[model samples]
Target: MATTPDDSSGQSTIDESASQVEILDADALADEPLPEDEAEPVDAVRPPGPSARQPAPLLPAMRPSSRPARSGDLLGYYLAEVRRYPLLDPEEEKELAIQYQDTGDPEAAQRLVTSNLRLVVKLAYQYHRQWANVLDLIQEGNVGLVEALSRYDPYRGIRFSSYAQYWIRAMILRFLMDNYRMVRLGSTRHGRKLFFQLQKERDHLIKQGIHPSTLALSKALNVPEQEVINVDQHLSAPAMSLDAPTSASGEGRPLNEVVGNDKAVNPEQDVARNELGEVFRAQLKTFETTLRDERERTIWHERLTASEPVSLTSLGKRYGVSKERIRQVEARMKRRLRDHLTRELGDEIPIYLEAPSD
Candidate 1:
C-alpha cells in the first residue's frame, strides 16, 4: 500500500491550502505550461538522480511480444499498461519524496507519481458522469498530481495521497466547468462557484426532502439568487451550433443559412441616424444634469437610459424598499426625460430608453 503524510498539522495545512486554491480556470492554466514540459526526454530531465553516476543497465518491456491488430487505441493501451507499476510502501514513498524535494530528482518524482497513477484513475472514475470521456479527467488529474509532487513536503508527515487528492479534484472540477458547454460557462468567479456547488447543494437539499428552489439553492451555495437561476438554466441547456441543421431531418438548412437578413441600408440615412443617436445621448446627459434629487438621478442613469438596465428588484433591495417604489421613481424620471426630449428635439429625432416592462 502506498503511504502518505497524515499528521494533524499536515491535515490542517492541507485543509487551509485547499480553500486558498486560486480561482483559475483551465484556460489560464493552459496559457502557461506550469506543469511538466511534455517535450523533455525522460532521461534528459534534471537535476539528474543517482542514475547519472550509476552505469546504465536496463531493458524496456513496453513493446509487446506480438503486435496487436488494434491501432490508435491510446486509452485501451494506457489502462492495460498502467497496472504494471506497483504501489510503494510508506518508507519507500517518504524516501522518494525527500529525494525529489531535496535534489529535484526527476526520477524520484516520476516514481512517486507512477506509484499513485491508480489513485488518479480511481478519483477520475468518480467523476465519469460529469465528463463524457474519463481519460480527459485522468490527464488533468495527472497534471495536478505532478504539480503536487513539486510542492509535496515530506517533512509535513501527511500522506501524499490525502494531500494530492485536493489538487486532483480542483483540476477536474475546473475542467468540467470550463468545458461545461461548447461556450465556457464558468468563466467568472461566481460562475465557477455555482458550477462547483449548485448541483451538489441541490442534491443535498433534495435528499433532505427539500424542493431546492432557486432561493434555497442561493442560500445553500451562498450565491445570488439570479446567478443561481442563470447557472442552473445554463447547466440544463444543450450546446447548439449556428452550422447545425434547423430540423431533425438532414434535409433542413443550417440555422445560420436560414436566418433572415436585414433590409438594405441607404448610406445617407444611416449616417443621419448615427448622428441623431449622438445628439439624443447628449440631450439625455444634459437633461440628467438638471436632476436635483440623487435617487431620481440614479434611477434615470442606471435604470432608464443604461444599455443593460438594473432590475427594479435589485435597485429596491439596494435602496431598502419595495420594487414598486423603484418602478414609481423610474416612471417619474422617464416621464420627465421624455417630455424634455420631445419639447427640445421634436418628434423627428429618435430617443430610445431601455425600460422595464410590466
Candidate 2:
C-alpha cells in the first residue's frame, strides 16, 4: 500500500512500495517521447519558453476589430473575445495604476484600461435597453473607463472597479441624454433626476392606485411641478418630423406646409403696399408742383421728405429763418400736404401719410 504525509499534523506514513520508486533527470524526463495515443500533434504544441506560459495582451483601446466580418458578427466576436482577457487582481491593478500615475507611462495606462474593459462592458449592458446601439454605449463607457484610470488613486483604498463604475455610468447617461431626442430633456439637477426617475415613480404610484398628478410626482420625485409636467410631456410625445404627413390618410399636406408661420411676410400684402407707396410718391410730387412758394417747396422736399429729415435748427439756419418760424412753416406745409393727399386718394391714403396730431 502507498502512504502519504499529513501536512497539518506534521506526520508521515511510509509503505514498502515507496522504496522501489525511480528518480529521473529533468532533461531526460522532458525529452522522453510519449506513446502515439498520448502525444499531442506537433503543430498543436508550442516550444517551451517563459512567454509560452504568459497570457496574451488585452487590446490597447476599444476600436472596431480588424477581422473581415459583418459589423454585427464582429461586435459579437469582440464581446466574446474581450471576456477572455484575465481580470487584474487588486495588487496588479494597483501597481499598473501607480506606474501610470507616477511616470505617465503609456504601456501601463494601456494595460490598466484594457484589463478593465470587461467592467465597462458589464456596465454598458445595464444601459443597453435605453439606447439603440449597444456598441455606441460600450464605446462611450470605454471613454469613461480611460478617464477613470487617469484619475484613479491606488492609495485611496477603494477598488478600481468601484471607482470606474461611476465614470462609465456617467458617460453612458450623458450619451443617452444628448442623442435620445432632438430637444434636450433635462438641464437642471432636479430636472435630471425627474427625467430618469419620473417614469418609475409614476408606475409605482399607478400600481398603488394613486393618481400620478404633476403635483404628486413633483413631491415624490422632489422636482418642481412645472418641471415634472414639462419632462412628462417630453417623454410622452414622440418627435415628429416636419416633413411627415399631417393627416391620417397620408395624402394630406406635410406638417411644415400646414403649420402657419406668423413671421412670414404675405406676398399679396407686400405687393399692394409697394404699389400704394409708389402712388403716394406720385401724389406728393404733384403736390410739390402746386407749392407756389419756392422756399416752402425747398423746406418740404429737403427737410421733411428727405430719407433722414434735416434737424429743424439746421433747416432754420440754411433758409435764414428763425427756428420758431421754421417750425411753424414745416407744420403748415405738412397739414396742407395731408389734406391734398386725403382728397386725392380718399380711404386709400396710407396711414403713415396722415398729419401727426399735435
Candidate that would win on TM-score: 1
Give the C-alpha lDDT of model 2.
Answer: 0.51
Deviating ranges (above 4 Å) for candidate 1: 1-72, 182-189, 199-211, 215-358
Q: On residues 1-358, what C-alpha lDDT tens digit does candidate 1 reach at each position?
A: 0111243111111123222323112222223323333322122122232232221111011222134423544344444334545567889999988998888877887677766666666566555545545556666676556656655578756556655655565566656666764225434557755654566567669869999999999888777788887777655311111232333243333322222111222332332223223334445556868896887877765655443557888888888999999898876776777788665543322233336443
Worst 10 residues of 1 by lDDT: 53-62
Cα lDDT tens digits for candidate 2, 1-358: 0112243121233232322222111122223342334211111111223232222222322433445433434344444445444567889988877887787777677666666666666555555445534556666777666656655677755566666655565566666655543224445666446545666577668868999898998998877788787666654311111333323244333332222111222332332223223344445556777886877876765555543446777768887888788778877887777678665533211122212111
**Backbone clash total, candidate 1:** 8
Note the Cα lDDT for every prediction shown.
0.52, 0.51
What TM-scores do the predictions have? 0.43, 0.42
What is the TM-score (0 to 1) of candidate 2? 0.42
Q: Which regions in candidate 2 have their CA more than 4 angstroms from the true location?
A: 1-64, 70-72, 182-193, 196-210, 218-358
